[model samples]
Target: MPEYGPLHGETVIFTGTLKSLEVFDLVRQYGGVPVSIPLIQVNEVEEPTDEKRMKTCSDFDWLIFTSQNAVKAFQSKMERFAISVNEIPCKIAAVGTRTAAALEKIGFTVEFIPTVFSADVFVKQFKPTDGELNVLFLKGSLAGSIIREELPFQVVEWTVYETGAKRDSINSLVDLLKSRRDCSVLFASPSAVRVFSEDAVPSVGWSGYTIGAIGHVTERALLEAGATVDVKPEIYTLKELVETLSNRKDEFR
Candidate 1:
């Protein structure tokens, strides 16, 4: 399977909030050198109230989860407010496989997962609500505006979690990852890319390195931060990222 699963012996650096142990295992399974340094710290937002949740649970036409962090933060807020998943009286939609899995684990059957993992594609693919579709987004602090801008549905956003750079972890990660022209640093979000680009610039420049982004948003973030992205999957899912790396003939080039 070397021709197909060719990530063996490759050093991959990961930086994100979820502590992607599953991704690490997947990398190892594909024979990659899995190095994960979580640089984005996730903190729950304390502002959501029972009144707001009560309105949200019963009012929205569709409740959309964009990330696993969103699902997790929503669960924590719901539990604190004594809200139940079954009480969310709307159709549920998740963006990625992991996001769908997280919701499923918490007893919510995901009603829709778009054919392509892009928010733009999801906006086009998902069947709208009967009348006006009001989407409640469980999102992080520095999330991109693709969903709000691109979707035809009315979006109500709740910042369920805050994402910030874990500089101590990033500094230490930079020490280990410097001068890795042959290595690929995989970024999953704009925040992670923001952190890495700011912190890792002192020791190494990304001009000669191979950078892998999870999606267009992340790719734009990396480019805006002056990092050259070399690889991204056909689909934006984490599993597909590894597969894309495995399948690419010259991933490190």
Candidate 2:
């Protein structure tokens, strides 16, 4: 087990997509107890509309994927269209390592990736060519436009997946937080923070536990919901978050 200090003996709760368990195991190795309470469920929306599919593939100079869910959903749509990932002509960009890994798994090489895996950094790096650099953004329906709003290119947004709060799971998280005196909560997205805060804010008093946010947006959401943020990783990835917490375990102790 890898050693981490500041997180030693802390109980951490995860509330988002558990695409990979590497982060969870790292937390435990660093002496932090990891708890997974999924607050948002991802559902794929697949309907064969030629107009939308054609526009996604043909009209875009750059295809941007923000999440792994988007990659999977887009891949599924591409299969329906009889389009292969290797055959695509446009440049591919992924917001984070996870999404980039998904693209790599599907045989598509990512041409652009930001240092920090956020829309702000991505927009800073995005240089649109003249004469309508059509960009196809594959992301969740509820995702905010930190990238879309700032891009100089002609952006076409597509909701490849929908995110909704898991209401039943909220009670369990509240109960766990209430019972445990020393525990931390992890928020991966602004939506998860919003959903969890809507009910969890009133149910569990915020003073006893630590809150870990993945990025600036998530931290802002957590703060807006009246919860104090204890940890936020500089890099916007789960692996980095776990590692940073592991390395700085003594701070929380």
TM-score of each: 0.87, 0.90
Best candidate (score: lDDT): 2
User: 147-224, model 1: which lDDT tens digit per residue?
Assistant: 887877788887888887888886667766664445678889888887777778766777555688899888888889
Candidate 1 worst ten-residue window by lDDT: 1-10
State the TM-score for model 2.
Answer: 0.90
**Model 2 lDDT vs. the true structure?**
0.81
**CA RMSD per model (angstroms):** 3.0, 2.3
TM-score winner: 2
Runs of candidate 2 with Cα error greater than 4 angstroms are 1-6, 50-56, 128-131
Instruction: Judge candidate 1 at residue 141 and give its lDDT.
Output: 90
How much is the lDDT of residue 160 in candidate 1?
81
